[model samples]
Structures are given as C-alpha cells and as structure tokens.
Target: MLKELDLARREAEVSSLAQAEQDELAELREWLAAPEGAKDEHRRIAGLRAEVKEWQETYKKEKASWMRAICELTKQRDLQVSRADLFAKQLGQWRDIFQETDLTNLEQEWDPESSFYANEDAERRECQP
Candidate 1:
C-alpha cells in the first residue's frame, strides 16, 4: 500500500511539472508575438530603405551633371586643339616664306629706278617707328 502511494505521488509530481512546462511555453509564445526588438528592427530596415532611395536619386542627378560637364570640357578641348593646329599651319607657311626668300635679293631689287613700292608698302612705311 505504501508503494502504491509513492507511485501515485510520483505521477502527480510529473503531471504538475508538465503543466508548468506548458504554461512557460505559452508565455514564451505570447512574448514572441509582440517582441519589442522585432518592431525596432522593422523600423530600422524601413529607415535604411528610405535612405538608400534618397542616395540613389542624388547619385543619378550628380552623375548626369558630371557627364554634362565632361562633355562641355571635351568640346572645349577639341576646339582648343583645332585652334592650335591652325596656328601651327600658319607658322609653317611663314617659316617656308622666310626660308625661300632672300633678303639680299630683295634689297638689290629695290633700286629707285628699277622698282616701285606698292600702295600698301607706302602705308606700311608711314606707320613704321
């Protein structure tokens, strides 16, 4: 009879433990359903998404503006290079004229009886220092 009483007591103790475990599990589920950390994490993710969208917009505008500036600069550079090429061609022409023409022959040909000055030369002489 004592053994039977012990067995009954053991069963009752196990049943109480099982009930306590079930109550603890139910409380844990309730806590998880409305967790403060989960809510905060969701808000943080939303804020980050908004920030990323703003960054993308800003980046697009900046990229477009930068590309326009680069195009303008490239055009200017091309114009400058063309001007330099034109100047170089003019300088080559002048150098060829100087190399081919003899200053001594010009002086010999400039006698008052044999040669005459053009109207432009007269005007140039008038302006000379």
Candidate 2:
C-alpha cells in the first residue's frame, strides 16, 4: 500500500510540473504574439507620419511659388499702368500740336496712316511691358 501511495504522489507531482510548464508556455506565446501584432501597427503609424511630412513640405514649396508669382504679376501690372500714363501724356501733347497746325497744310504734310496716334496704339498693343 505504501509503495502504491508513493507512485501516486510521484505521478501527481509530474502532472503538476507539466501543467506549470504549459501555463508558462501560454504566457510566452501571448508575449510573442503581442510584439508581432504591434510591429505592424508601429510601421503603419511611421508611414503615415512620413506621408504627412512630405505633404507639408510640398505645401510649403507651393505656397512660396504662388507668392512669387503674385509678386511678379503685381510688378508687371504696375509697369503697365505707368506706361499707359506716359502714353496718355504724350497723346495730350500730340493733340495740342494737331490743333495748332493748319488743317490743309497738315493734310498735305501728314498721311493719316502715318499718324502718331495710330503708331502709339499699335505699339501699346504689341508691347506687354
């Protein structure tokens, strides 16, 4: 009877050790799976951050280009207005000369197609600056 009891105790101890080993293996599996699952999430977040940074840099460059274009256009527009003003002043001087000259003599001396007014209009239309 005593020998049977010792055998049973030994069997129970072995079963307990096996159960403890299984529990430790389960904990290790859970820890291993956790790192594997988290790796994908970490990589995805890193990719998103990189994309956002690229977009931010693109926007900054675009905004700077837009500002430069706007400034150039403003300068061109100012120059055009100044040219128009100078043309108007010259026209006024030409009109005064026309009024002072004798019409019959002017007709003989000047061709209508060769007038300053016609040339000025053509030049203004041709020259963007």
Name the top TM-score candidate.
1
* Candidate 1 residue 75 C-alpha distance from true site, Å: 0.8
Error of 1 at 106 (Å): 3.7
RMSD in angstroms, candidate 1?
A: 26.7
Model 2 lDDT tens row, 2-92: 4785698679768966986886577556656777787677557657856976896698679768867987999999999999999999999
lDDT (tens digit, per residue) of candidate 1 on 36-101: 977666557557856976896698679768867987999999999999999999999999999998
Error at 111, model 2, angstroms: 17
- TM-scores of the candidates are 0.52, 0.49
lDDT of 2: 0.78
Q: What is the C-alpha lDDT of each candidate?
A: 0.76, 0.78
Model 2 off-target regions past 4 Å? 1-36, 104-129
**Residue pairs of candidate 1 with colliding backbone atoms:** none
Top-lDDT structure, candidate number: 2
Backbone clashes under 3 angstroms, per model: 0, 0
